[model samples]
Target: MEPKHKRRVRYKGTHPKKYNEKYKELNPELYPETIEKVIKKGSTPVGMHLSIMVDEILEFLNIQEGQIGLDCTLGYGGHTLKMLECLNHTGHMYALDIDPIESVKTKERLLNKGYGEDILTIKNCNFKDIDLVSNEAGLFDFVLADLGVSSMQIDNPERGFSYKKEGPLDLRLNPQKGIPAFIKLQELNKNQLEQLFIENSDEPYAKEIAKNIDSYLKSGQLISTTTQLYKIIEKSLSFIPIKERKES
Candidate 1:
């Protein structure tokens, strides 16, 4: 070839990267309608949790500017975010989550949204130890504890919280602290299992389900997954006809 070919130069700043970190915050107009759609559909967007009863919570708390508060279950930081907005970046929020993975991610996300430690402080600890943690952080004006497994935790099969999902039977709120659900199941006797189910969930078929699960454990068939436990429960109740089944 007689003519020399010229190489095209690419500008890094002009060309958008494959992953844009600021897209979520920078594009505010896109989310209002999207969130409304999610609310109407009664489904949370993937990787996001819709704060339950937010208006009620905010009203009850009546968080004023420069007031300190504690959010005991900071699963997806939805409640924390709302509380922070109410505080108007002047007050401090102590957020607690047993899930370390989620806590870190939420902390970083909030920080990216212009909230620093001065505004939001996250603790990777159980709310059961709130007395001790709160003492160190000083007194709080308002405390909100939403005690339940969050949507994010249940949605992720790897965390092993959902009965519908086929995942490990690890239901410990703090995976790092206590024994997994499978081990706990193996340790409990039929009576203990029945009592647990009755007290915790008020399952009508608790006794039968407990007996089946205990038998399975005794037979050396490890009930280590959600589906396995689900099958055991199903088999235990299979004798009852669908027509005869009463809602608990």
Candidate 2:
């Protein structure tokens, strides 16, 4: 007998609050209509990254056929794909990203689209080490570096980049390299936490937030998830009105 076919995952309501639960948005190719609808509503689909300022970037670079191009940050390969198109499959493009997981997935995705070894090369390396890449590939005719946290990184709950969803408190760009945020949080003292809040994000209620987090730790409660930390922040600023606190 043939193996049983599983039904598609069903969400409780019209909207999916969890990032992983967004099955349609995750698979954009298989559900173009849903993707289009999400885009039309001025929201990017989960697990899909729309290249920003595509025309503006192309205009500035003025990439030509048979020219070498370097993409310093290949998040979802959207910009890389466009740059490859500008090369018209004649020249080669080299892309680098710190995210080993996403970069490998993107390499396979581009290969499927016919951008093989001859046309595209992707490496799981930081842009800070561009000299290494340049040493191998030589000088680039044009370079594109769209810097910022990728939406894929921010939106994925498992990546732990955002507090909007509950997930493991791991926030490293390369999850393999460093200790997780949860570990880091446990290590820092109250004063260090306050300084970190101010120095890192310019948070005004740094002292209060840090104090509360310290309190939880002193009580032997480990803050393990994004939501757990988010609640601690909320409680710290509970005195602020709803409107102002919401912005925080």
Candidate 3:
């Protein structure tokens, strides 16, 4: 029997604006043109990643066949794929990622692309466990650690990495391992919240945002979703003059 064809999802606008609705971005392998479309905007494709600075890193490393390497952050496995090619199938590449959900998908994707377990090994753990990895795999000839949140995480609304989305305010690198961001917000007092915003993000409206959040939490109001937190931030900053808001 033949496979059934699925129709594209409909949206309000001509082009899909919602992350989930962007069929091209959400399925880039099936839409090659979307590659340049996203790259021009300096954004990774949704549902996947295009590793940055590949040439620079490869040139600097000058990897050779038969040499072992470690990719401390697998992400969507883009960088690891390129590095594995430089090994020319003669050596091994080990990678780590904290996100169990995405990492398993990534391992499968890489395998489908002809990089099997013989050449690539993926571990689900924090990179700080390098000591443990080294004890098992021996010292690496070279290492690559991309220290940042993956685009897959940012674009997936369910992960709640972006405040623009309508998901829960999770804000966790590993959703299964940590308390959600909403809980943390509930725990912070106004002054502590102010300092957290200032020290962590340098948010200019730290004082105002913190004051409002503290009041809301104290009043027993809930803020469980990304949209709720975003509204609070907007309400806190509404005191700015419209002209001033546009100017700055």
Which one is best on lDDT? 2
Answer with 1 or 3, whichever has the higher TM-score: 3
Candidate 3 lDDT, tens digit per residue, 1-248?
A: 99899888899968877777888756676776877787789876677777889999999999999999999999888899999999988889999999998898889888988999999989999999988999999989999988777887888898888875698889887888979999998888899999999999998989999999998898889999999888988899999988987787
- Candidate 3: give the clashing pairs: none
C-alpha RMSD of candidate 3: 2.9
lDDT for 62 (candidate 1): 94
Candidate 2: C-alpha RMSD to true structure equals 2.7
| lDDT of every model, 2 decimals | 0.81, 0.89, 0.88
lDDT of 1 by residue, 1-248 (tens): 67888644443686433222334322333477766776689777544576789999999999999999999999878899899999998979999998887788778778888889988888888899899887888899999999877766676666788776588899876777889999999789999999999999988888999999999999989999988888888899989987676642
Candidate number with greatest TM-score: 2
Off by over 4 Å in 3: 1-23, 40-43, 239-248
> What are the C-alpha RMSDs, in order, of all predicted structures?
8.2, 2.7, 2.9
What lDDT would candidate 2 get against the real structure?
Answer: 0.89
Error of 2 at 185 (Å): 0.7
